[model samples]
Target: MSPTTVAVRAGFRRGAIELRNTFTNAQDLWGYLFPTLILVVTIFFMRGSTVPGTDFSLGARTLPSALGMGLAFGGLIALAQQLVVEREDGTLLRAKATPNGMLGYLVGKLTLMSTTALASMLIQLVPSLFLVDGLRLTSAGAWLTLLWVAVLGLVATLPLGAVIGSLIESARNLGLVMLPMMGLIALSGIFYPINGYPGWLQAVAQVFPIYWLGLGMRSALLPDALAAVELGGSWRHLETLGVLGSWAVLGLVLAPVVLRRMARRESGSRVAARRERAMRQVF
Candidate 1:
């Protein structure tokens, strides 16, 4: 087969393997389940409040936002850590030896991450409709925005995760990568409105993609929130599209460059030495 054809087949096979492996593994189950647990807990706590100034329970707004956060955390942090672990275990090296290996391997990883994100989002949506009030979908446009935001949010974040996974030296050090990202999620209005945040804080939040993802989601699901922003002289729809697009472009450009450099440094002997050190520490 031609190199391109071989790569495509390899990517499909690898992605399927990875997806199955994730489902079978207890650790991977927890990777998704833990965030979901947190979501459930947050919903339980917030069940008493109605949607701001409405008969709708707070769960409507809160659950959907939590679901979005779950998708982000799963696609971004969980997938990134898996990549780091796989790299450490020499899976990446083995893949590298194949035709167009890196491309195929990345395709697989992205595929798996996207699937997981979609599943997580759907699971969150059920509770959103039944438990939350004023949680009605008023128009087709809102549904379209939600769908795109979730999909694009995954697209925008996953490449950056891959870049980080490639750069980090060890799985143990994954926290060094994930912590800052989680912090950004917290600051990005995932749990609350950006309006509640101070002006400077909102400005800082705007630097990251999660902020826009959360904003876009809110716009789709909460029309009043969008209208409020319009009254404040902010074009939230334009801003959301622009910010998300910018991050997607930036990640697409930067992630490959970073991955290539890191792959070069991760030669066999270096990886072996690192694994040996890690084993010694474990023992």
Candidate 2:
């Protein structure tokens, strides 16, 4: 087999091992279960409230929106955190030393992250069916839309995470990304509707993938009449595709160049230096 093919197979095996590990490890399972619990609780509180301008359950609307937000968070923040932590601990350097190792490393990481994201989504979504009402999942169209939006959301966000991970020198600086991400989430209409926001704010929110992801998810799960509450009184599926696809293109083009540079910079001295800094912080 070719080097690429061998690397791909090895990566697939590694991802499978990692996925099993996630289930067996106590902390990892908690990581999957805890957020879902919180979401359930939050939605429970929202059950008494209705969506603005309509009698529909706000909690139900929030469920799909939150799922979209979680997808983006997984692709962006979670992936970036993994890279930074692994790089700090010398995983990236070890991969760099092997033939076709970087390719295998990336492939494995992508598989692991993608599967983890999907698992988390399912965990949150399945129980939510019981908690929330009025979801339009009886049709095949709803599911197809959900699947495509999720895949595209991952495509748009994962490479951007890789790029960020490559650029940041330390995991301690992840707040630089996290704080901004939280701000974006607020603007993205995850917990509430963005239609009521000022025009410029709505415009700003729409520029990022989070807003589009949430919008897409809402479009798939919410009633068609709910579109009246969205901007332009429509689902705007074309714009969702356009914005997310643009991000995917930009990230796909840029991530490899940045990751290559990051790999090139890795050495024993750099890893040791990071360890020393971490020790200093602890002391």
Candidate 3:
């Protein structure tokens, strides 16, 4: 087999092993489920509320929007977090030493994170059926849209996450990533309709993947009539595809260059220096 094929297989194996390990670990199990449980309760409470202009449960609408946000969060934050933490501990240096190591490492991470995000969405969605009304979960179209949007969201955001991870010198700087993301999330209309915001704010929110992710998701799971509440009174699948595809293209072009630069700078000495600084910050 070619080196690239071997590396891809190795990466898949690595991701599978890590996922199984996480499933078996008690702490990891709890860590994964706890946030999901909290979101469930949050959704349960929103059942009383209704989507504007229609009688559909707001909670149900929130569910898909939240799912899209989950994709964004997983693609951006989780991958970036792993990169910084692993870099601090010399994992990146080790990977740099091996043939096709970076390729394998990235593939493994994407595998791990994409599965985790899908699992989280299913976990939340299944229970939410009991609490929310007007979801089109029964329809095949819903699942298909969910599938493609999730895939596109991953493609759009993960490479950007890699670029961010490559740029930051320390894990502590993840907050810089978090703050802007949170602001975007707020403006993205995960809990509310983006149409409620001013036109300029609406335009600004549309520029990021979060809004498009939410929009794609809402299109997938919400009712057809609810589209009236959206910006153009339709799902705008074409626009969602265009915007997300553009981001995907941009990130794909930039990630390799940034990651290559970051990997070139990695060394034993740098790892040691970073570890020392991390220890200082901790203690």
Maximum-lDDT candidate = 2
| RMSD list, candidates in order | 2.5, 0.8, 1.2
lDDT of each: 0.74, 0.93, 0.89
Model 2 lowest lDDT segment of ten: 100-109
> lDDT order of candidates, best first?
2, 3, 1
Candidate order by TM-score, decreasing, is: 2, 3, 1
Misplaced by over 4 Å in model 2 are none
**Please, what are the lDDT tens digits per residue for candidate 1 over residues 117-213?**
8877776666556555565387998899888888888878888788777777888898797678778877876766566678888788888877777
Q: Stretches of candidate 3 above 4 Å error?
A: none
lDDT of 3 by residue, 179-280 (tens): 999999999999899787889999999999999999999998888999999998899999999999999999999999999999999999999999898888
lDDT of 2 at 61: 89
- What TM value does model 2 have? 0.98
Kindly give the stretch of ten consecutive residues in candidate 3 with the minimal lDDT sum: 28-37
Query: Please, what are the lDDT tens digits per residue for candidate 2 over residues 128-152?
Result: 8999888999989999999999999
